[model samples]
Target: MESARIPFTERYHATQHGGIARAANSSVTCKTAAGRTATPCAAVQQGGAGANGHYRMAYIDVDSDARTANSSSATLRIPAGSRVSYARLYWGGSLRGSGQKAAKDNGRVLLAEPGGRYRQVRADTMTGHRPHSATEGFQASAEVTELVRNSGGGAYTVAQINMATGHSTAGVWGGWTLVAAYENKKQPLRRIALWDGFQSLGADRRELSVRLPGLRIPANSHGLAGVVAYDGDRGHGNDTLTVRAGQHRAHTVRDTANPANDVMNSTVTDLGRPTMRWPAYRNTLGFDSDVFDITPALRSGGDRLTFRFTTTRNPGYLLGALFVQTDTRR
Candidate 1:
């Protein structure tokens, strides 16, 4: 039987190698010299080296507990006037637990958002990690435009990344500002999930919503919040998304909507970084792909809202947070 494809928001299950590499959201790959790191120079070329010589490049993966490693602090240059919007962390790890509680401690890996400089993004404390009751598991972290942290351990190949200027949904009028080292590899893309009741404006039974896939937003720095709804196993609804803006009380819950729904504990700081727990189990927490309604006290086109709409969802689950925007810059 064909497995049912849930909402447009979905998590990826990358196959593992061994030891720490087996953990969820963990991955590793080999690249050329110029392609050795996150932001590769577009002018530079990669060829002459033998199989052994081409095996030097490594992209490290790190999560909450492992963000302080030496590998996470690599440096690079971001064109002086480059305006960074979003940063994504590609995680590769093992998911071999059963039932909801089995993967509770090791659910998802969360990377920290960029502060003044680009730092790694982590999962919410309550949702990211589930206890490692299972056997061998690993976790890895990827950097965005080289500004974010790149912890060593579970380095995976960079599937696709375009850091051109301006948020061009058209993809026709911009230069490749930052290119992934593993652009050639078949890396899993990020997934966007949505929910009702969590926003302030309330769900729109009529209009559909959508946004750019893998786009970055500041951690708690006031941007658009996207949402999606499965609506009881009826496939997907309109791609349209409705974002609600305002001061709404936010809380975390598990994938399933049961009393035992897994809860994620998180808090956004002034610096806009959220320290969250990695979810060990698998649920659709960050698996929606469309709109995010508010918790009942706000509206959509108001002051608390920022961010413009993008077009599609790449593939896997993306770990990050959303905030109310005081201004408009999308």
Candidate 2:
């Protein structure tokens, strides 16, 4: 089955609430190497190695609980019946130094799970600072599907750059933006129905039609089935429902005036009045369970299915809902 992707952005700020990294020498005073006065610095200095090294990088620590206080961490919930099959994380920002080492120092964006486990989502090796220029930084992304799937379909969480490791590098100083992609699990048997709240058919309107597109049938699938529910003005009249592919008739269900006459083939009931009255009919046509099949009616290269209704009396028939089902193939 084909999958669907849902994209969501993190709901937190990267720098607020003590999320940035600052080195011990981040505020060090710079003195002229030979014979000049020390200069006051505004940004962390680049180059040099040691405890008081000048290179320092800031990072956002994305914590699951930080969503309320910091906003850098986020939790995405999967719907109750659906499972997550795949996921990915995207993040990007700027680096402030040059050369391979500075680029390597860019660190990585980490994805954190609920139980203190973490995985590297993407590397932030984009380096070089272009001050006051249109082009300024590098952007990167990473796939976190395994971690997301392991989280078991609910509350998948993520952390900002270097937060999971608690180690900060120099020459990396920009806020990061993040978004996640997820694929929903596929169902073995799928049902597509037509029951939009505000639509129906009647005497004023004699026919109702619906077009369903993009339905996929796996190579190992068995077949398809369909059912429809309908009613008339006084629970009287003969009507027919048809399923088609372009001009090809796939299946049809016909209603009779006498409920008892079609009792074995349909369900006849009185379901209220005005809003819903009696003489409602529900039936499934084309093949019984032993040999149920409708694949031959479906066009091989196309995925368009159409449903139609016709009536023969005044205050004709109002269609309720039409449902089509297909076997699930692993």
Candidate 3:
């Protein structure tokens, strides 16, 4: 398939506007836990989607430890019948935060087959590609290194999957960052139906009953509680980001920074553990006037919460965030 010649601005707008449709269609074959060739129940999109199909940026927490904390690879699902003709993975290692700008790199895409696992498709490839900027969107016209270097952190990779054909594929390609191409047609704002949807958690042998108050904001609101999980790399302290809501004080929390567990009491040195649970219960919940006017408040949707994590650390640390929305419609 010919490369999609999308304008840099157009791609940027599309990526931020359209969130991911579906990462992988169900027809793709994958090795199940039992070691049988099986189809994934659903196409898993690690990071949250942006406005359109564009995905929210994820990171690789290379904070203190560099060896074990560094990420190796990530996975992207493809439908059973859809043919993945072309694929690419974008990465950047720049510094641009508070007022910092690091260097950039030109990353490459490596192919992986079923049963083979996500081994490096190539070893001689150079790591100096500019990741597609929020403006560049899905097309590989941008470099991957800039995204990371610009973020004021270590190196980072942005994954994208190219699906010109919407059909399912045989075996899903691993390490392909499937980014949002473009809509078959322009979607109007009025056509947007902001409603609560159901997310099925089929794994872990557990079920959660989610509650959505509504889409409207209530006059008087109380405390808030949410869940934060990590992917990619080693150690628990990797997941760290600053969260701000209008005049409310911005707070920074690491995946292992939960007050529930006493750091002094725990003997485990590593913070980011699979079974590490953060105590997440609040007493009284109230929403101040400043809370209603912040970016977090405006973007308050039932299933939409800003989650920042490293995809480079473990290649799977696609952070997940869920916020409760109370509709004032009643």
Candidate 4:
């Protein structure tokens, strides 16, 4: 844990370009409660795939075509008249349940853009994998900006994620998110920044602080934050995300759909609807692709903003992505 924790580093950073949108879905499914709370439900209905404390889990095979071993599709919606400037796909899970053979298969996957055939894609960026008891969590990503720029937006399916499917001491979990930043002259000038790495939540570093520069916040500006992480429990409590304008006091970003104490709980959330996905599960069992408002935390006229993610007394989590979008001076 010490070795894996000390080296929390960066994977991808956008040099330039686009508004932000994400298409995400869980690769695994399990039986759980109805309302999708941390509280255990005795009813144990067949719910969408997510990180739950109870029930057996399995891979989600939404792609009946079945040219690959495992596959799932998610919807990436870019507004009309917008061109994609950047896109990255992230996927991983516990290799322990699937046996160590998958360790060699890390960073390799299949991605199919809307109306296109399957193409091999590898994690051209950082690959984060660490061991914790019986569960070894790993996350890998690949840049698909070119594919996305040409293909536009729709249901994008990813296959061969190479994650385990079943109940484990740590709970079987894996998923993918297609995050794209677009350019639309019709929209307000905005800054879209993305940062990713294999950073630990509690093992060695309890906090992740990212400083983003060259942002201008005007009055009545809209802001958003997005994240991808692994192994976060449903109600482990004490997890928080905070953001601050340069030289200003920090404010904890809050949302009704997301609990401050459990920011990493499994789920893929967007702004209340237009939720297009193949298997839109409220809980992803262990994977998380969450979005929340940071507009309340913004201050006018800043060249930089700092983003922080911290855990006080929760089990470990490996953060894979951090994205920020805000209106800026063109």
lDDT of 2 by residue, 1-330 (tens): 101111112211111111111000010112212112211122112211111112232232334454321113333435444443334343323333232222342335555554545555554222222233211223334445466556643233344432111112221222222222223344344423222111223435566666665455443333343222222222233555556654455555332321321211222211111101111112101000001134555534234566665665543322322334443222
Q: Tell me the deviation in Å of residue 105 in model 4.
A: 0.8
Number of the top TM-score candidate: 4
* Per-residue alpha-carbon lDDT of candidate 4 for residues 172-285, written as tens digits (9 for 90 to 100): 778888888888877777878887777777755789887887666775677888888887765566778888887777888656656776677665777433257777766667
Ranking by lDDT: 4, 2, 1, 3
Once all C-alphas are superposed, what RMSD does model 4 give against the true structure?
Answer: 3.8
**Local error of candidate 4 at 186, Å?**
0.3
Model 2 ranges with Cα > 4 A deviation:
1-195, 218-230, 233-237, 254-296, 299-301, 327-330
Between candidates 2 and 4, the one scoring higher on lDDT is: 4
Candidate 2 clash figure, as a count: 5
Better of 1 and 3 by lDDT: 1
lDDT of each: 0.22, 0.30, 0.21, 0.72
Q: Write the per-residue lDDT of candidate 3 for residues 1-330, one digit (tens) a residue.
A: 111121111112111111111111111111221122321212212111111111112222212334222222222323332222222233222122112222221222322232232223221223222133211111122222222222221112222222111111111111222221222223211111111111112122122222222133332322222231211111222323333333334434333323211111111111222211111101000000000112334333322223221221222221112222222222
Error at 122, model 3, angstroms: 13
Each model's total of backbone clashes: 86, 5, 79, 6
The number of the candidate with the highest lDDT is 4
Residue 224 CA error for candidate 1 (Å)? 4.1
